[model samples]
Target: MSIISLRSILDANKLSGNNFNDWYQNLRSVLMHEKLIDVIDKPANVAPQKGESNASALDAYAKYFEQSTTTKCIILASMSPELHRQNESMTPAHIIAHVKKMYESESRTSIHRISKSSFKIRI
Candidate 1:
């Protein structure tokens, strides 16, 4: 089945909504339970940005965004620790604006990097 179809089934069955990470986790669980796919984690070798500690919630959400880049970056930024850091200037609104800007002006070379990766996304 298609990704949208699978996602629809989950939503229709009340398995998920408004929580993409949880939705994907549950979807993968179902796919594995049905013996339809193998388990894989962090299939991409791309590393987190330098100085972005993995334990930081911002890093965690960024990683999630990297895995699911099709999702809005604002949504990812909404879940970032940077939004909550007392010293940070990154308001959710700021993040939203930056996300929109990045989305609209993203370079082709960045897109090429993703396409060149060998990770498989099985339905």
Candidate 2:
């Protein structure tokens, strides 16, 4: 997808201190649609040195790095200026973790509000 179009999506979903869950879900959906979900899910294991029994890990890491950088670009393209500033230096994995923390905290607050309101209803 074009970076300009992706930036438009980010602009529309700008995070203004709330609505983290919706923003994150939309961002993730976009990333998935771009076929970058592997960057969020699978990280390459450390490569063994030459002469080690399991040198194949090196190849895996190479592949992972290639895909991960592409994924990072997609994510960066879809971030608002504020969110991008917060995570500009982070790796793709760390960016996802940071977003999850921000959004999950808000989700808990929403759940609490729902439960509190539910208890106030009379049968």
Off by over 4 Å in 2: 1-8, 45-63, 118-123
Write down the worst ten-residue block by lDDT for model 1. 36-45
Candidate 1 lDDT, 78-122, residue by residue in tens: 343442242134432343345335433344455556676734443
Clashes of 2: 0
TM-scores of all models?
Answer: 0.21, 0.64
C-alpha root-mean-square deviation, candidate 1:
19.3
For model 2, residues 1-123, the per-residue Cα lDDT tens digits are 645245457567765547677767777777677766777877645556767765467677777778778877767666677877888888888988988787788787988998999989943
- What shift in Å separates residue 66 of candidate 2 from its native position after superposition? 3.3
Show where candidate 1 strays beyond 4 Å. Answer: 1-9, 13-17, 39-123
TM-score of candidate 1 on Cα atoms, chains taken together: 0.21
Index of the highest-lDDT prediction: 2
